[model samples]
Target: MDNQALSLNNTIVATNANVLSMLSERGKNIFFPKLGILAQAAQARGKAINATIGEAVEDDGSSMHLPEFDALVNMPTANIFPYAPSFGKPEFRSLWKDSIYRKNPSLKETVISNPIATNGLTHGLSMAAYLFANEDDTVLLSNHYWENYNLIFENNYGATVETFELFANGGFNVADFGKKLNEIEGEKIITLLNFPNNPAGYTPLVSEIATIVAEIKKVADKGKKVIVLIDDAYFGLVYEENVFTESIFVELANLSENVLAVKLDGPTKEDYVWGFRVGFITYAIKGGTAELYEALENKTAGAVRGNISNISQLSQSMLFKVYSAPTYEQSKKEKFDILKGRYDILRDALSNPKYAEYFSPLPFNSGYFMCVEPKKGLVAEEIRKHLLEKYSTGVIVLGSVIRLAFSAVPQAKLPELVENIYNACVDLDK
Candidate 1:
């Protein structure tokens, strides 16, 4: 049978045996291609300013300024080189749960279980897709989302990707989301939410988050299985006072038995250890028993074992120490302050009157990046290429909008970055 028929018939499974078949059908995606091409160009052209990359770049254009978990570096050979358990160390899991509560105090009353270790947030998401989503399942997301999700749900799991408007009237379109949920013809539907959202770094208002939870519960009440995967890769980076401080995981977790809240987060962006590649997959199933969580853990561990055998022991050990450190909270606060300062620069720069003719900045106050919609008669790809060829500037082009990784751009160089973008618009116009 042809690939199309296989996909239509739902015969292709994302298992080791059918890997080739799955790749033939759903593996083609554009995120990595654009990222790879621009990343290579950015590196090859020395002195080029690359804002397309997502990792937290130092203000001086240096490498990621990660936390100093020096104790791990000097630890005994056994601690650094030994294999981590497939499910992660018991103490490490416990420490992570404690850290989660500290970061999200709202989750303190929302009975939850320990998180399972994954290679990173991406891996955690991939595993969740494999375990929960099936071929032909519909995974819903915001219109403004990280493109890797396409690779995870549609490409890898053979699931259908649906989207709802991320914003309406300068706020989250909760009504549209609910409408989309009801429209999807499936008993099982997955909603993947990322905040502070990538590409367009916006966190919803607290009431907006509550509306989302209520919508999910309404669907669950109608006898549909809903998986709400909270991608908190950029957690705790909110700048505005109105935005919710806690992860929406707590509220969704308390909603209904048919609703499952899966949180994917890591030290990559949170702790500034992008290279460490340490992350977690935590669960919140309403009225879930301890036994159920343990089974979920084992299944998740099995998925991890089959995929990469196990994550890096060195990374896990190092993170374990950081989680248990006496000054971990203080260290996180210091880093947050730095990112917040950079965010302020981007916010002020975007608000300048000069850029209004070029593009309109989106509503954003948190996260590492923000987005802008180019004026009419302009194409995002054309603008991106013009910026690269004419000015040696690199930014991501997503449909009609362009993303600026202000987090990667230096504070002093912010003005120059803005000038370059505006200049690119002028050059393209000419």
Candidate 2:
């Protein structure tokens, strides 16, 4: 149909506000497409979410855990045998809140009372999508971001994702981040920033976080609610001089009533309990008392009720044990140091002349993965395939860039592992 004809056929409802229009417009794109990885996951196939979503089943053996994988997942009896609350176990939520606020003492008095638990980071992400996203509201995101965020913000919530590149050449891009803020004028937008990124592992420095707040303030100055969702999946793993805590979470609160910060983070990446899958949604509503907190909590619970029903009872039960454990921080800190050790080795080896010339590190402070923008002629996939097929090594490809998970490989094996990547690239050059 012609543009004029299409316009003729559509009637604008007088009461349909700009927010609704924005929501409708944004709901039409593929920001985050669901991955086939879940098709292979037991929970995806299990009665839990499977029954509701009605996705096709893979097989029955999935019900019985594979022996080797089962052994690694050895949780205390409570974690395995019991059920958990939908929101979260009370004590677990309280302890988890203590873990969050205690990390940032500057905000000991800051009231962030409502914390909703999810099965994992993804669950909290999806819940955020469900809660704030309108029919097609724009969810502004960092240019280089976690892929799965697209699925939650765009695919599921009916939101359009806008972006600004977070960094360049191993440093933060404050100007670019500011420019993106200037571009938005009307409509409700939820701007999300993920740190210790999935592919890049870029954590903004303290100055960078301050700069981000200043930029966000410019937007909120225009009377818009800046719902800045911070995905802190990899927390307490800071290996560099970076702004690592509730800086934005605290700053956003002081900025405006229009500024509501939703922090989507969890235990999946934190406790070395990947399979345990416990996460939480924390709201940082500045200057709000019990009444405001209650209202927000009610809405948050409504979002949980509408979307997920509740986080797993079993996951919550187990997390409570970890919460109550005396060695929680000490044990967790040791694990973080271990992942940190692996990252250090990769960082040191990446400084090698041979590999250093091949790529530049995007601003990375801490996280499992790091991205490399291939120099000149090398395509990310081609090099990735070359590495995998010939060297029997694996790496993830992101557009023209390649992402390496240095944290997963053992610290002792990092030298040899990097050598494999280095050698593969050299062969490609030849």
- Model 1: per-residue Cα lDDT over 285-360, one tens digit each: 6676564555456556757766776788888888888877889889889888888888888778777898899888
The C-alpha TM-scores of every prediction are 0.82, 0.80
Model 2 over residues 178-284: C-alpha lDDT tens digits?
Answer: 88877765645578887777777877787677788888887777866677887888876678754565535766655665566788777888776788777888876
**Ten consecutive residues with minimal summed lDDT in candidate 2?**
25-34
Candidate 2 backbone collisions, by pair: 23-136, 23-137, 32-150, 32-151, 83-313, 84-313, 170-363
* Candidate 1 residue 56 C-alpha distance from true site, Å: 38
* TM-score, predicted candidate 1 vs. hidden true structure: 0.82
Candidate 1: stretches off by over 4 Å = 1-72
Error of 1 at 121 (Å): 0.6
User: Which is the leading candidate under TM-score?
Assistant: 1
